[model samples]
Target: MNPKWLTRAGLCALLAIISLAASAAPAGPPRVAVTDLAYEERVSEYFRVVSASSKSSLRASGRESERDSDDAYSRRSSGSLNARSESNYSSTEGTYSYIDRGEMRKFTADIKGGLIKSGRFELVQGKPFTDTKHTEKLYDIIARIKQGMYPGADYVLFGSINSIEFRQEANPIDHTNTVSHTLSLELVGEFSLINTRNYAIKSSFSAMGTGQDVKLLTSQGGRVVLNRGKVVSEVSRSLGEDVARQVEEQLTGVSSAEERDNSYRPRGESVREEVIIFK
Candidate 1:
């Protein structure tokens, strides 16, 4: 064989081997960073404890100056206090937190686990968000992604609590004086998956989780405490899984996918929680 011909054949053989190896090797799955489940709560009911000057202050301030007589017999001392009639009270401020930031991770616990279990994508840790200005930043998926909240991730899964409610009721038993103290918790959330490189929304959906706790009280006046931890855990688990499943279905093409929809925007947001305080 000619030396030039052998050299060409050697190069061809090397190229073929490289091609074969590339074809046999499996491609890595897309990497995804599941963001913190952001949420905004509106004040459904709230109690404001305003401490103004005592009501007595108004009476004293409104009292007219009396003309004094030049005799001690005309003078009498009234049992009035030295309290100022002017309204002077500071606006009461209280620290409010529904759940710990660390515990908030529970909201997306099952989503992370489900993604791992499915073996469909590589999971990465999304960055922790700080409270800047307002809670709007918490659920701003686009802003978060642009801020590198999902570093080294090909996709980002953004979740936020849309609404959550707790309801309580008391009902009497059919044939007894016993009453049932029932507490029900329900939460709804929305999610969006976006391509980190292009910021294209790959998919979006909403999911809900609900739980209830009931106790039988012997008398109508009996008290009951609802199982908060158990209910929250149940809600988180169920909500996370539902979000994860929809994500999987949309990403893996198991169902009709919402692809390349450029006009998609994240959902609207609401404000603070409502709780009462008495002192």
Candidate 2:
């Protein structure tokens, strides 16, 4: 055979294989836009809750009674005692929030991170939804979709916080003179994935996360420090992951967490609860 003719034949065969492989490749993963979780701007509650086991609240009531904890100029009850001398004890309550409007995205960000980490979908930046608490501006999910809040996204993962709570408890540890302080935070949220084109919901689920910080205190009315930011971050991250996993399972019919090997935990990962001991 002529060398030039043989070389031409070999080139033709290589091109044919390349063309076939290209055609056989699967489509790229679906693109997703995870919106910031929506919530009602909480009515700031000005009130004091005290209990025999809640020394932290007692101290908070005492400090807040003597000083203005919020400089944001919220509506406070007059009986709430417009900040008096340190020696005065005022039994007043006001309405305010423990969280700010700007920080609510931590929950949404967690779920987005989890979905991205799973590599099951491509996540995109999403625009903010209207403040749900303010009725002056009606919430129109369809209009928001039409405005391209999540441009170039095939689906939208919408989430809303249903309930959130924080509490503290203190008790004497057994066989010791020390007191145990435990601070607990819990958050619950509802989620749904909707097809942007037809406005159909593909999947819906709810996820909850809880975190606790425990420390030992001296019996001398010692206080337990509360890190609202730290615990919120921890809970949001775990909550996001849980929501992401649930979304994946629901949409793809994968195995549930209970059906899998739940006992296996990777090394170096932080646990949701931590214990601190003080003698």
Instruction: Identify the leading candidate in terms of TM-score.
Output: 1
Question: What lDDT does each candidate get?
Answer: 0.73, 0.73
TM-scores for every candidate against the unseen true structure = 0.63, 0.60
The count of backbone overlaps in candidate 1 is 1
Best by lDDT: 2
Please report how far candidate 2 places residue 226 from its true position, in Å: 2.8
In candidate 2, residue 90 scores what lDDT? 41
**By summed lDDT, which 10 consecutive residues of candidate 1 come out lowest?**
260-269
Candidate 1 per-residue C-alpha lDDT over 36-128 given as tens digits, one digit per residue, 9 for 90 to 100: 767554333344566755434422323334556566334334544355444567566554444322115557777787677656678998887
Error of 2 at 272 (Å): 31
Q: Which stretches of candidate 2 lie over 4 Å from their true place?
A: 1-24, 41-103, 130-139, 220-223, 257-279
Sequence-dependent TM-score of model 1: 0.63
